[model samples]
Target chain A: MKRKFFSDRDKLEPALITIFAGVFSVLVGVGLIFIVSKDPVQSVRNFLLGPLLRTYNFYYLLIAMVPITFTGLALCIIYQLKYTSLIVDSSFYSGAIVATAIGINVSLPPGLHPAIAMLAAGLVGGLISLLPAILKIKWRANELVSSLMFNYVFYFIGSFVILYYLRDRNQTILASMPFQKSFSLPKLVENTQLHAGFIIAAVFVVLVSIFLFRTRWGYEIRITGANPKFAAYAGIPVATVALYAHFVSGFIGGIGGAVEMSGLYRAFIWQMNPSYAWDGVIVAMLARKNPKFVPLSALFLAYLRVGADFMSRRGDVAFEFITLLQGLIILILASDKIANYFKERRLKRAALSHDLAAQASSAGGQP
Target chain B: MIKFIISVFSSSNYWFIVLRSTAPILLVTLGAVITEQAGIKNMALEGSMLWAALTGVIVSAATGNVWAGFIAGIAAAVVIALILGLFALKLDANAVLCGVALNLFSTGGTVFVLFSLTGDKGISSSLASKTLPFIKIPFVENIPWVGKIFSGQNIIVWISVLAVVVIHIMLNKARVGVRIRAVGENLEAAKSAGISPNRIKFLTLAVSGVLAGMAGCFLSMGYTSNFTSGISAGRGYVANAAQVVAGGTAVGAIFASLIFGLTDAMATYLQNIGLPPELIQALPYVVTILGFVVITLIRDRKELIRKKKLFEKDRAKPLASGLGA
Candidate 1:
């Protein structure tokens, strides 16, 4: 007989795994502290407890999270459609590059440039995102493989544009000309360097949550993802929904790129960002692809990233110690069977106590 | 033109350069082909290859043996591939997500390790490492076209060719080949038949790792003298395309690899001919895009024909029923 106390679908597993991942991540953070600094313990405390120790660092962490939060929410749209096998990350990168390209090129008024850049990023990202969607629906091509390949194509194109065409010869390194100062998002805080992008990101997340939970189109996407054949039988147009999902995913991903570029750097910087698209994927995964939860997840990740960077600077440890820890955590999460073991033990003990109480009550009544 | 042909054949230098460039990509694609045939989608080949290359270089630098580096490279790739296989096949995580994670992990882990190792932020040098050497066959130069293509090539080239034959035979003629094909076709049916789909997936993934590892070895130790931080630059995706274009045949994979090799060579030639570097650089991706378009067209056409046949079957079915009634 199956035990009622330890059902397979218990939420406790996820909770335990989350705690384990957090602790493991901090442990790695401490190790990095030792590697980089003479006093590893102090370094760990500074990193884990340091950001919280100062109101300034905490604000910086929030500022750092602005772009990722936007990107992460945008990613959750595609993740919801179960088309994650396709364009989530590609959309994110394409958005950033498109936004950067326009932000650097256009000589717009200062107040309008940020908005224009964000929209441009979204549109570009969205358009590129549709390539794989079109292929998948029209020709039955594999979305995952094609989207993955398109990223490289975009990389080469972006690099070529940045290096030969747009590169600022005045600068020591290869990068774009200083983006028009007009493109900078308005500064919000007095003492800190945080921009208005954080507020914008938060607002966008709420809007996405509403669209995902309340809209008719969103319902169709959910139904289609849950069961395409059933959705088809129910008269939902699977092809149209799938295409729409890809298009929207691409659009938001693009916006993420634009916001990130405008908010963080004065100009288009690297040939590519450190796979922010992939980080968006990580965020989406941690949120279990929920549009509402992505903001929180993105912030958590951003905190870890910001803390790790600070830790490395303050101590002797390399930045890769964090990556190894992240990988370990992700690997554990991927294995549901292994992750659930910790939670199962807790439930087993709880059930044993309940049985013992029932036996003692019956014995007392008989005496 | 005659001089060009003669120059190609006469110079071991030309053959060596071509062989070196092609070997890693070919082996990597062959590994992808193994998984593709087993109906497993693999985008982690790039990550596996990168990881293997990093491991191979580090091991060779420490051990002072090219062969030891080669083994270490293969081992590194296999371990990564095994993790992917376990996640994809056993745990039911999305294969594509696993591929993405592997790529991310490889990129970050390698950079972290590189920073830790040499305190360099970019390419690692060949200061203390042993690189694989090109082998020249004795008196084979006396033969015809076979001699030109086969002799004085990287050992990886020979291994890749042998791999093609081995994979072809194992996939087509062996009992296990039948099971692998069955698993690819329908997992549920394979499970009902007691063929164990997960087992086949694991096996194919292992094979993929070995091939990808060799490819990494060829890349770091065979083709290039040193390893760069961003090595295996999207070769894995191309390998997937090669597998798809080849229609899951090992021989077809070789032909596809040749096409890619020729395209890469064409890009180099274009660069040499003073084509804009931007245009020249775009060549590989442009070619891949074209490949995707052409392949999609072909697949659509085939699907159309199949639909027509089905329609004919339905129409004939009505006439037969009417006559019988």
Candidate 2:
């Protein structure tokens, strides 16, 4: 019963591998800066320290983490359903449009308008996301492709709504009319643009963590994700679980879009996909699809992004250096061989000890 | 609307545009078919096309030769495919994750390199890039409508058409094609027969890279003369949809790509009308989703019929034997 340091079933092994992958990728990022920048040392210094040099930049980093936290949580919920649904992107757009329309049209009181808009946005997003899930359940269509194609459809519809229906005639740029002032998320930190969305994101992290781990429905979802056949055998309605998971995932993404727009901008201004949904995939992976870790992972990505922005401003290094680093990290982290090598070694040793103990015990019994 | 449709279809120029636009999607879809046949989901097609487009523009600009650009573009895409294979096959990484990473890398990395080379994040207009020349068939030019439909298209268009035939023959008849299909259908059987599945997958991805690279070159050198950020747009995904709708066959993919190409042409044509640009731009994607739904429904129905027939056979066997006795 002696515990080994590097056993196959050791809980720390994945964390160790992820940490090593992170360090390795950071080194790769620095090496890339060396190759690309004229002053590699200055660029590296700026990338590492620039985000913390100013309070505003630090706040900007926090602000950036808000949207990704929502997306990361959204991805965590849907990915557990065993579907690689890209409909989160469409849901984000649909939610933003719905929220914008409500914010502009509704005449609710100051305290109620933004809340109502966000709830409506979540509903729209959930409905939009349900299309692909239904398609998968009913017709056996590939969810990934359908969802991807749906993103473009929803994107255009959202754009058309903004351009044709909600256009502010006074402005030349293609944007919807500004939301009523009362509809915007209140500033949490004055003069730094940090808003209540951060608070909501944090709350979401806790709520999603509880939902995924604490409830009977959550247990059913986990079982369904781990094995659909087993869940079916266990009398869990697998289809219903999938539908609910998709809705919750899309609901989170929708709220993210609404909160992001309300927090940062006054109007509906996005003409293209903001790619937060794509970044969500990376965040979820970095967090290993754990809602509890989404905040940390989102912060890590946001910090890298803010640092990249600062480096681009101060040095010759392009902001894309972070993307390259992210790609390398994901490639390394998702590689099973890296983790499997240690796992197989530990398992082999355990098997050998098991065989030796069995043989010795049998010999002693015979004597 | 009817008049607009009639006017668009009656014009020979619309057909020419459809033919021209179909080339890239056809090439990419054929590449997708090859990789999918080898049981590798080719999600990195977009990244491959984007990287190839960048390399095509840069090398063509540097060398002032279009053929050199095409070769370099293919080489760059092959390198990407090799890396993808290294991760997905050798290291046992999730293919989808590797694909998403490659796509994000291509989007950012292309702009990063573009900025480094020309200090422009948007377009490579500063580079004096050479485009592939159009080829006019001498005898075909004499035919009235046929000539207009066939003559004076980009050379890549003809290559893509010829590729469909070559791929069809290769997939159905060639030794490598048989091995790829075997590996795709049953990895255990192929492995038990001493065939290396990983090697076959690597080769399949490499071949896919070549075709995707060619498609990328077509975008830069035939469709446009300079590289732009996101030049591949969603054509890579559309090609993938085409492959899926075609059931991963070369001929079917080509025809499906043509339908998408027609939608593209229609979108362009519709832009001149009073319709909003957003709706026009969404036509191809909407059509692709509809195509997928229809195809899935047909496949499901066929499967149900097959199951019913099997059940009927099982039920009839005992009764038929009893009657015979």
Proportion of native contacts kept per candidate = 0.35, 0.68
Q: What tens digits encode model 1's per-residue C-alpha lDDT throughout B1-325? A: 5765565446655554555566666787778878877888877888899888888899999988888998999999999899898887777667777776787678777777776677664778834677787778888866876577667677888888888889889899899899989999888999999998888988999999999998887788877767787688778878887777666788878766766676676566556656667666666656665676677779789978987777777777865333221
In order, the Cα lDDT scores of the candidates are 0.75, 0.86
Candidate 2 docks at the CAPRI level of: medium
Among these predicted structures, which one has the highest lDDT? 2
Candidate 2 lDDT over residue span B1-325, tens digit each? 8998999998888999999999999998998899899999877888899999999999999999989999999999888888899999999987877877787778888888988788888899999988988999999988887789889999999999998998888899899899899999999999998889999999989988999999898888889888999999887777777777888789898778988899999888889887899998899899988887887888889988987777777677875433121
Per candidate, chain B TM-score?
A: 0.89, 0.95
Q: DockQ score of candidate 1? A: 0.37
Q: Interface RMSD for each candidate model?
A: 2.8, 1.6
Evaluate candidate 1 and give its CAPRI docking class based on DockQ: acceptable
| Candidate 2 lDDT, A1-367, residue by residue in tens | 3355346455567768777877887788788888888999989888888789889889999999998899889998887777888898988878888888988888888758878888989988998989999999999776876788889889998888988889898987778898898888889987879999999999999999999999887788889999999999989999999999999899999998888877888998776778788878878878888898898889888888998899999888778767777887778877888766677678878777776778664344321
Off by over 4 Å in 2: A1-9, A352-367, B319-325
Each candidate structure's TM-score, on Cα atoms with residue i matched to residue i, is: 0.87, 0.95
Which candidate number has the best DockQ? 2
TM-score, cand. 2: 0.95
